[model samples]
Target: MKKQFAIIGMGRFGSSICRELFHMGHEVIAIDTDEKKLSLARSFTTETFVGNGTDESFLEKIGIRNFDHVIVAIGDDIQASILTTLHVKDQNVPNVWVKAQNDYHHKVLDKIGADRIFHPEKEMGSRIAAYLTSDTVLDYIDLSADYSIIEMLATKKVAGKTLIELDPRKRYGCTVIAVKQKHQVDVTPDPAEPIKEGDILILIGDKRDLRRFREGELS
Candidate 1:
């Protein structure tokens, strides 16, 4: 289903969201104080506005309440970012997501009822650090402080073994949610399905359990 999205900044992050959503056949309205930045978004979205996003009147004029999702991706000026998120939330946009600059920014966005808050830099940094530091972990997703999802390459130790034989859930308290080999992906793969040497196993579990499981794989 197509969704309508309003992005309140034309910076790298906001522009990326606008471009992707528009390319995916969603209605994307891009706004920025910089006319030049807004102009860059024109090819991706038909609706481009130059205005102060912090102003409730400007938001109202743009029909922000009509949007299914609104993203406040202001990179700098934490005050403007907070105020714009406040105005968007006040307008009662159903899904309001914000790019938080810091922990302080994240807390403020949460206080103002942002549906989701993301630290894109921190997230990417963590994922990259994981990949760089671990041979088995190809990707990592932080679900919470304790829980995570990890994509691990099936090494020689586990190659050609079935999931039931591995019994990750019983032995390590992790669940293999999916397996991908080349272009093909299997979700909730059968216990009898054999894992290939290069297959990527997607597992979800507590972070501690994941570390232990990975350590065992290394040993």
Candidate 2:
């Protein structure tokens, strides 16, 4: 299903979203105050506009209300971002997602009724911290304050063992969600499916269980 999207900023984050949506065959209206940024986004977006996003008249003129989803990706100027988001919400756009710079920014967006808030910097920091803190954790995604999904390399002890054989749920309270190999990804691995030394296991569960698994406590 295709949807119309409006992106209010042309910085790295907004540009990336515009490009991805366009590549996925969605209609994207990219708006920015900077002429240079608008020029850069021209080839990637379906439509480009140079205007002050916080201006309600400008937003109205551009048919912002027609968009199914609007992303407020304004960088640096928290005031502008908030104003734009408020205007978009006032227009009653069905969904509004905002990129927040910090905790304060997130709180403001939440109070103003943003459907979703993303902190890319904080998320990337967490991912980098996971890599730096442990050698076993190939990737980490925070599912909640106490839950996470971790991609871990199968150690020698776990190689050739099946889900039923290892029984991670019983031992560690975690579930193996998928197995990723060089050539394929198995989302529905059988209970008897064998694990290889180089296979990457995608597991989901409470954060404590993940930490225990990472420290080789459950091996």
Candidate 3:
């Protein structure tokens, strides 16, 4: 289903999101105080506005409250970001997401009822660290401090073996929740199903257990 999104900034982060959401067929309204920034967003967004997002009157006039999601990506202007977020929330926007500049900024946003907060630099660093840590890991998502879900490419070490033979739950302390072979995805695959080389396995496990499995099995 399509969603209506209002992005109240046009910096690199906001512009990238606007383009992606537009390409995904969602309705996006891009707003910024700078005409140059608005120009960049005009091609990708359904609407582009040159105005201060912190101005509640301007926001209401643009129908910000009607948006399904509102993103506050004001760059480095903490006060503006905060006021914009507050106004958006006050208007009762269903989902308000913000890009926080620091820990203090995040705390303020949290207290002000921002549904989601993002630290792009920190998140990208963590993702890069995960990629550098393992060669077989195609993707990683931290479920908690101790648990994670990882997508690992099945290699010769694991090929031609059934889940029963591998017994990952008992041996590696990890669970193979799904497997992707070519374009097909098998969720909760049968224990007797053969795992082929080049297949991708979606596994969930404690961090330590995942590291052990990666070293003893994937390596």
Prediction 2 TM-score vs. true: 0.60
* Candidate 1 whole-model C-alpha lDDT, 0 to 1: 0.82
Off by over 4 Å in 1: 123-188, 191-219
The most accurate candidate by TM-score is 3
lDDT winner? 3
The estimated TM-scores of all candidates read 0.60, 0.60, 0.61
Candidate 3 lDDT over 71-123, as tens digits, reads 88899999999999999999999889898999999999999999978887755
Candidate 3 whole-model C-alpha lDDT, 0 to 1 = 0.83
- lDDT by residue for model 1 (70-89), tens: 88889889999999998888
Better structure of 1 and 3 per TM-score: 3
lDDT of each: 0.82, 0.82, 0.83
Error of 3 at 70 (Å): 0.3
- lDDT accuracy of residue 85 in candidate 2: 95
* Candidate 1 positional error at 115, Å: 0.7
Report the CA-based lDDT of candidate 2 relative to the real structure.
Answer: 0.82
